[model samples]
Target: MSISTATVKERSLLGLKELSRDEIASILDRAAHWDRQQEKMSPILNKHFVANMFFENSTRTRFSFEMAEKRLGAQVLNFAAAASSVEKGESIYDTVRTLESMGIDAGVIRLKPIGLLAELAKKVSVPLINAGDGNNEHPTQALLDLYTMKQHFGELKGLRVSIIGDILHSRVARSNLWALQKFGVDVKFCAPANMQAPELAKYAPYVSMEEALQADVVMMLRVQLERHGEGVLKSADTYRVQYGLTEERAAKLNAGTIIMHPAPINRNVEIDDAIVESPQSKIFTQMQNGVPIRMAVIERAMK
Candidate 1:
């Protein structure tokens, strides 16, 4: 399941827009192989330097990227928003330019505003991987989640997957919808009235949480506390009652249906703490797959 370098001609991964199905499959397969043989190979044997520029607070994505690069024998420089020159009002362009001037191999960025990655991509000469951009997308997370699903179900096509929770502010939900739809999965979404995703018409929508939970795969997204300022949700308790996946709610899911989440989970907020540790949970595996998937992405971009 290795992707020959000859197969992927494009040298950058600014977005998922340019990839075809076979290319995506190849990448996922390669990632899976890397994950299984993590100790055996050092793909990035030379001291290649990779920079992580994260504007928003993160734990899983940042660490995952760092582990991925380092495991492949690359050096990693992590720049947190609070510690960086961004605190001095230096613009994103200047920060990226400064890093590029250091001769880094690639940049993994997680910014807040929509289209910021696109803007950054235009300015950087090296490969720019969009770790996240506002509520727009988290392509790497989506790739890992897709890879997790394929591992669980043995295929991607014809699988029914429902993404439930705060869609309006979740980059994970948006990316999952696109990746699932592209991979031929039947995608559905569930959220409270006010928290319904903005791009509803693009994918199947389930007005009730119950309906969405009936799918073969159920994914719960963490509620962004920042969205409370945007008037999207009134209170955490109210959101939990209306849309959270409680033990009773989990009972409604189809038998053996896989449940997933991108981490830093709010226990009893989006999903009950009990369910997160249950056998049905794939949330941790999703986090576990992040490393190899990211490694594959960096390797692909470097070529």
Candidate 2:
């Protein structure tokens, strides 16, 4: 599809890579509208049916998507992979098609495998919101992260954001890099050699934690212990000492720097428990913004 066509109608938010700058701006604008409670009283999505099909366990993303759909006055069908026929050798394509067959307006999915979502995208005509897909991208998470930043700083251009943690498995990091780059937000990744994503070199060369602490925004990624390659974790204590955001390190940051993490935090693993509650931390606010940002996405997508 042409850029113009994409701008008006995005079928599935598979990844931020497919979104143009104008499209990103439009989504953020709509998100702000929801954030400020400026939405119409009449439900924009009345009678629409949406499904949240999560193959992986989640506390935030799955529930937030359900909340977003309901707030828009859409009926929700929640599907858990553990209890579903997915365990019975059913394919992702067949499952999504089954939902579409039931007249579901859209589907939100979080799958463990990387490319299954793209395959489902090809087979289904209804819109799909990627909740999280392996190490690929989490487009809505990036949208809410950007929305949170805008609420605090009012703009993105020229602002520096330092992302720290398990970059290779972080869909959050990849999606944010795409949006940040479009908005002219300078980005740097800080991670141990074992955790850094090499493809992110174009954003900014990987920097030490000490070096990245100087940025306007300090974003921490959850260390994906579940997906770390074999032998990459020699010692958790060693990682914390070198890269984790301990209280001592948090105290050293610029007073004006915004601390963020796309949470389900690993406590003292990615960031210290004390720092997670610090005045500078926007982790909770990021979670709060998820609903509105997701509401905006569902509203725009089903239109």
Candidate 3:
């Protein structure tokens, strides 16, 4: 698609890579405001329409955004590619343009194409919120993560965060890296050699699992076995022995340190099932936090 030189009028939340510290802080603060409200539904966005155009499958993100939009009283339209014209070979651009032409105020889109969201943003006049764009970024996930950490630790500056697992294929990892670095957090990555993103080496060091476990936050990435080439790693059992947050490894964490994961967890693969909801784990809290953070994002996009 050809890029447009015309000015884009809408305020979109595409990613955190270009967001300044103040801008991110503003979003988090607004999320906190929404979270503290007494009423369940606020009609701040009444009469506005928001369409969730998911070219990829999701449960948590799609539901979370829908919940947020509804809470603020916006009408929503959910689009699933598998059941739509997309399955018949209609292009993604056409699908979004069709919605835009129908007068949707903004779009929440998720897709596997890495740079397609950016290209679509140029072509579409309505605001676009990226649900996830390949492995490039998942901004709201990272924002909720920051909110979860901040709620626990009080301040984020000088915190040490180690993100471990499939670094090469995790949009969560990339989003967290960019957002955390803005807050002066020391971020580290721990993954198998083949799973490392070499381009990010200058931004953060690739550390050993033992070293990663020592941080203030030990965040595990989902082991995307499907994204890996066949035989790239031995097996899930072998991966657990080496990199998974087994019960033994969890015992070694500092009493003050917290464990986290972006879920649809692989049970015993990336992390032991016993440790997922333990006192030290904030895995589920991350999901709960997503609603408000996304509410803040949608409010920003529409208002």
The lDDT leader among the candidates is 3
lDDT of 1 by residue, 1-303 (tens): 333333323555655645677877888998988987837458563567789999888877899988888778777889898998899999988998999899787788988888877777766677788898888888898899999999999999999998888787777887787677878999888877677765664676665777788888888888887767766677888878888889998877778799998888999988998999898999889888888898899887765
Per-prediction count of colliding residue pairs? 0, 0, 0
How high is each candidate's TM-score? Answer: 0.92, 0.94, 0.97
**Model 1 residue-pair collision total:** 0
**Model 2, range 1-303, lDDT digits (tens) per residue?**
222334423756878887899988988998888878865343778878988998888868988888888888988899998999999999777888899899887889999898888877766777788999988999999999999998899999989999998887788999999988999999999988978788788776799899999989999888877665477976667778888998888989998999999989989887998888789999999999999889888997676
Candidate 2 local lDDT, residue 158: 83
Q: Which stretches of candidate 1 lie over 4 Å from their true place?
A: 1-9, 38-43, 229-231
Q: Give the best candidate by TM-score.
A: 3
RMSD of 2: 2.9
lDDT digits (tens) for residues 161-241 of candidate 3: 999999998999999999999999999999999899999999999999999999999999999877765888789999999
**C-alpha RMSD for every candidate:** 3.5, 2.9, 2.7
What's the ranking of the predictions by lDDT, best on top?
A: 3, 2, 1
Scanning candidate 3 in windows of ten residues, the lowest lDDT window is: 1-10
Task: Judge candidate 2 against the unseen true structure and give its global Cα lDDT, from 0 to 1.
Answer: 0.86
C-alpha lDDT of all candidate models, in order: 0.81, 0.86, 0.93
